[model samples]
Target: MKLGPIDWAIMATYFVFVLGIGFALRRYMKTTTDFFQSGRSIPAWVAGLAFISANLGAQEVMGMAASGAKYGIMTSHFYWIGAIPAMVFLAVFMMPFYYGSRARSVPEYLKLRFDEKTRGLNAITFALMTVLSSGISMYAMGLLLNLLLGWSFDVSIWLCALIVLLYITMGGLTSAIYNEVLQFFMIVFGFLPLVLLGLHDVGGWAGLKTGLEHVAVSNGFAAGAWSQSWAHMGSPTDNPMGVEWFGMAMGLGFVLSFGYWCTDFLTIQRAMASESMSAARRAPLIAAFPKMMFPFLVILPGMLAIVLHQRLGAGGFSLPTKADGTLNYDMTVPLMLSHYFPQGMLGVGITALIASFMAGMAGNVTAFNTVFTYDIYQAYIRKGAPDAHYLWVGRVATVAGISASVAAAYLATHFNNIMDMLQLVFAFVNAPLFATFLLGMFWKRTTGHAAFIGLISGTVGAAIHHGLTLPLGSVPGIKGGWLGLTHQYTSEMAQNFWTAIWAWSTCFVVTILVSLVTKARAEAELKGLVYSLTERLKSDAEAWWRRPAVLGVIVLALTLVLNIVFL
Candidate 1:
């Protein structure tokens, strides 16, 4: 894993451009809109790429790779089944209300569509979620850098934090979006070569499949289990993922996917930055293009790492272990980079990871600052502050958010799989959120009080469900069952899926029941917010192919083909 001077030079060169972009955009930061919302002037394509790149952080790169190592091709479910349809639904159905309502953040939308309490609840929780998610990006970078460079973990995380802070604080959302686009390119170029080389070493797709059979069989799964996506999903015991198709479809695919893609403000903020409603709608639909290709760049590396380690024996690397003596799957991607990459290319690979780390953390910080400035601080702390004063608060919030994330980074260290921890958070937060948004936007009769009550009930239900269920072999603690184990799941991921399902169902049911007893808002007040009340959106695109629906259909078809091919 030793690096040469050539590798150092490549990394050094990348930092210059990253900082230069921020410094270049600093002159435009005279107003809050310019700083926090990118002046709503970014083109659809730029916003689109940034949409995907904003998510290209620790969870996507390291976490997906980790899941790939543990679950094999079943990990692609995160993209094919879990992400694609949801992105399509967002662009085609949800973005109209989001863009049309002129809401500043997701919480602001809830306020416009529901009530103050629901908005307040979402804003505070979203602020915390962004900080924690940002911390994940920080923790992964810190840990990976420590492993690769033998640097102190504390110093590495802090240094990365300082770099992101300067750029994001300087140019704000505009800087974060532009840098995310750059990170997207760097990630593709840097990681595509690794995938190519790894595939070559393992005899391409056929050889990789052959190699995975032994690993799958040794782990108590059916032969060829690692090579197929849905084939082994009929029974939890048939595959490494250890969840039935029903849970996979209803939980990860329906609840978690729609919850994140539709409701989470991180990716939604990128689209909201676009110049026009047309562009905003097009953003996520277009982002799905690159999102579809990421399994190879990230997931395949993990799959290859595992097989290659076994094939190459002791000279090759093994995954790191947790304090409890189980494999720490989060190390899968970095270990693969160290094993397969040569000196010059190794720098590119490392820089790609750095780019992802920055895009992810910066996206979170920028979103956090905006939500704090508008949704929380403006609404609660100071109602009539001047834009100048609020702008000042945003900059201050950026500093505070990063500081909190640095603390939260330590919290992530307690988990064996970083993805497991992130999913648990999403299950508690986003899963129930989709229900609130669903009823609020579609059923004008849904009252604000009902929405607020439903949100609390959903979050509480998630906590209860999580506490009552234990992932097999995990003791009652962070992984759940502290309240007493009523049900046990085969894997942590399986537990996450079912927990999300329970949370979503609870929220959906409670919202409807409460709405029946509560009085609805005036129909006039629901105008631009509710689906039945609002007029349908017309595409501004001149060509048929440019329409969001057209693009969404094309991508979904391609994704379907991939799923079937892999199956």
Candidate 2:
């Protein structure tokens, strides 16, 4: 596992190039807008790439692969169903409110649509989640470096924190977005070869599937688990994912997907940074093209890992294991890299790993700084501050955000798996967010009080469901339910989907009930914010094919084809 001089050179070159980009973009930070939103001057393609890159962090790259290893092709549901539809919805339907309203952040839109309390709740929750997610990436980076390169965990964390802080502080969101694009390329370059090589070693896709089928047969599981997506989804006990089709669609596709893609400030901020309304509207759609194909790169590696492990045996190509002999699925990608990549390419693979960590960390810190500065500091602490003063606050907040992430990284060390911990957080924070946004945008009757209370109730409901239903000894950091309903869940994944379902249901019902009793805002005040009041701004100047609706239809159709093919 020792890296050669050429590998070191490649890694060093990547760091220099990224830092150089940051310094080169330093001239753009002339205003708070530029610092926070890239002066709204980014092109549609660049914004689109950054939109996906910002999310292509450790959690995604590694987690998706991990899920592929654990749950087979069913993991593609996270992409085809859970992401593409929501991303399309964001681009075609939601972007007008987000972009046309001229709101700087998602929470800002809430403030305009609902009230200050709703905005406050969203801003604070989003800020905390961003930092914690950054911390998780940081922690995963350190853990990978420790496992792969024998680097000290603490040293790895601090080194990554310092690197992210340096580039992001120098150029702000503009720098982060640019680096994310670069990271996206690096990830493709790094992992594409590994997948090709691994596929070759596993004797191509057909051989890999056959190998997994044999493994499943030997292990006393369904033979089609590795190849089929929906066949085993009829019951939780039939597959490793343990999620029924209804729960997968309603919980993951409708609730979690929309919540993250449409509402989460992390990805939305990238679209918001686009130079024009057309670019903003097109960003997610453009990102969706690449996203539809990402399972091939990310998830395939995990499937290959399983084939390699089964073929080579434990002594030949080792899989990461916990003390209890269970697979540490988060290490799937790293294990593949260690097994397949050679010297020069090894550096590329490791650099991609580092790039994912840095990009993810930068994404979170940049979003955190922007939200905290504008939504919290400007709105609450000191309104009408000089633009320069706010810019300074943003930079300071960037530092604070990264610092908090470092602390959170330390906290994450206690968790057994990075992907599980991330999913747990998503269940807690993101699952219920879409319901509030869905009501506020389309329904003018959704009062601020209702939005705020429903959000709180939904979040609390998610926690309660976890406590009541999650089984003991199921996964790390989760014990049996306080209500002694531990036997209710067929698997932890099932528990997660059900948790989201309950959370979303609670929010949806509660918001409706409260909004019924509360007075709706005046129509004049709802202009450009609510769906009914806003004009349908058309992109008529563009060709018919380029229209968001047209692109959305194409994407949806393609996604349907993918689902059927995999099913």
Candidate 3:
């Protein structure tokens, strides 16, 4: 995993180009809107690439590989189950709401729709989540750098963070998108050959099937592995993966996708900046195809790596094990590349991996800047601040947010699993907001009082449920555990998952019930804010609907095909 001079050159060149792009575009980012929201001037293709790139971080690549190494094709559900559907739904149902309303931030929409308090609470919640989420993204990139190049984790974290900060501080989202487009192409071109080579190394498709089945039967993996039937996509306990089929699909496909694609600001920022509403709607759809192939590029290689690992004997590319004798799943991708990739190709893949980290950290920093500036600083401290001061504050916040996230990365250095931590964080933070936002969008009766109550109550409810599952003994049945929760508890992921669901349900139901008792906004007040679901866009925007029925049918067909193929 050592880097040669070539690797260093590539990395340096990448950073220099990124910074230059930011400086070159400095003139374009004149106003506060330009600095934070790209002046709403981004083209559809640019927005589309940035949308996908924001989600394609080092954690995602490594996490998918880890899942594949541990669980086989089952990991594909991360996109098939959740990401694809949520994005499609958003495009058809939600994009119109966001683009048509022309709100600067999503939380701003809450204020226009409901009341100021709703906007304030959302702003606070979203700002906090942005910081924490950015931290997790940074930590994952650092983890990747440490594993691939044998660098110190802290040094790697700082190195990645500083480079991203330089460009993002100068160019804002404009530079972020510009660099993302370049990285996206680099990643695809750089890593795809490895996948093709992997299939070759493992022999043909038939040989891969033979290798997979032989290991499945000989190692006493579940009978499902050898069965052509895809009924049980999840690995059994005896297999390397600890979860079942139902768990993987539902977790990745349903919960994670909805949270990341539908709600996360990092990805949404690009869509918000589209040149026109139609262009914005097309951005997410353009992203879906690439997203669907993520598992193919990232996950399948890891699974193949596992097959190669066992064939080479236990001594080859050995990973440090925990007391439970489990292979450190985080190391799966690195170990595989070290073992199987050709020496020359290994260097290319390593460089691409590093590019993945850069892309990820840059995206996080940009999103953090947007939320901190628009949602927190401008909204609260400087409601009437001049454009120049606001831009200065954005630059300052970019640096500050990056620094804070880097600190969080250092804190997360001790955690073993990035996906688990990410999922748990979203469970508490994302679930309630989804309900609140959806209610505000669709229901005319929902009041500011109801929205505030739902937002606070749902978040608090999640905290309580989170506490109960922890080993803190703070609640009688709970024990202290990971992330300052219950210790050594069973099914903590499942517990957190269901707790989040309950939180969302409670918030939605309570918000609705409360609205029933509260006063409603008058017709005049609500006129501009509300839109019918069937509202038609003008001709200019209608072109963005290029083949909606076609896209819907394709998505539904793919969904059913995956479910049937892997059922």
Give the alpha carbon lDDT tens digit for every residue of 34-70 in model 2.
8999999999999999999999997789899999888
Error of 1 at 154 (Å): 3.3
On the 0 to 100 scale, the lDDT of residue 185 in model 1 is: 92
Candidate with the greatest lDDT versus the true structure:
1
Sort by TM-score, best first: 2, 1, 3
**Per-residue lDDT for 56-78 in model 1, tens only?**
78567888888888889899999
Better of 2 and 3 by lDDT: 2
User: What local distance difference test score does each model get?
Assistant: 0.88, 0.87, 0.70
Candidate 3 global TM-score: 0.87
lDDT of 3: 0.70
lDDT of 1 at 9: 97
Q: Please give the lDDT score for candidate 2.
A: 0.87
Ten consecutive residues with minimal summed lDDT in candidate 2? Answer: 471-480
